[model samples]
Target: MPGLSPRPEAAAFLRRWREALIGACVAVLGLYWVIFSFGLMIWIGWAVAAAGVVLGVAGIQRARFRAGSDGPGVVRVLEGRIAYMGPLDGGTADLETLRALRLDPTGLPAHWILDRPDQPPLAIPVTAQGADALFDAFASLPGMRTEHMLRSLNAPGGASVIVWRAADPAQKRLH
Candidate 1:
């Protein structure tokens, strides 16, 4: 079972979930203070509290989205032989191996695109640091095909992607 076991990326998703939860809590606290400091009516406080709760829930949902497969860190191997442990509902392309990965920093939530021929691309939203880690890992793999680090887009925290290709240079494309 060489690739049967889940990859380290699975663990990364969980770690991100925890971090998001903590960040959400801090945000909620800040919202509470902002609302209370304004000294609005009791109803306003309740409204603000409700809003915080909604935001917290949204953050949790986002974490779950990322933790699931719908957000980021989702890896699709190939057709009929997909390996997705995240929350996305559909199956993925059956790739023989990872061919090329393109990082798109233009998106509000930066995206990672894995390119494989004859199959729809696999897209995942990733943090700037996560993208860097992915690039490093892919680069270290034996027989990696990627070559250039094309134009640097304005990624959060100045993160850039490492481009890889199987037969030719992967074109810098945004999804």
Candidate 2:
């Protein structure tokens, strides 16, 4: 049993890629079905393969959103809030109330700035513990452009970029 356990670095690597690897395996199985199945089954296989491809693409983006958990804070996404407990600073941002999201790349490890209407912004390092959960959190935002967020997160150091902004309160009231 001990021998079967992966080494620390290997475990870390796998942890970072586990979803993508699972997606790859699913896609392969679907492809195999497409190759050897009967007529109706062949149609089913195509559907399965299509679903697998979508899962695989999402997994790849999630993997890209993951930064190592070696940074200075621990992030917790609970209910509808994201809380960051850092060495020198800490705060919480309610998803329902988040007004804007920004990427500040001036620090050694970049930070995600979560803005809420009445509170100071919560600055969470991209590499903080449990930061990967942010992918789902950010995705839940209406009209969030995920690819742009991923690109900005991985870009070279520069000025802050606003990744998302909540719709105007007046517009929401009209709806």
Candidate 2 accuracy as TM-score:
0.89
Q: List the residue pairs that clash in candidate 2.
A: none
Against the reference, the lDDT scores of all candidates come to 0.51, 0.90
Which ranges of candidate 1 are over 4 A from the true structure? Answer: 1-82, 85-96, 128-137, 141-162, 168-175
The per-prediction tally of clashing pairs is 11, 0
Best TM-score among the predictions, by candidate number: 2
For model 2, the superposed segments whose C-alpha errors exceed 4 Å read 1-10, 172-175
* lDDT minimum window of 10 residues, candidate 1: 146-155
For 58-101, candidate 1 gives per-residue lDDT tens digits of: 45544432313334444533333444333553234333455766
Candidate 2 lDDT (Cα, whole model)? 0.90
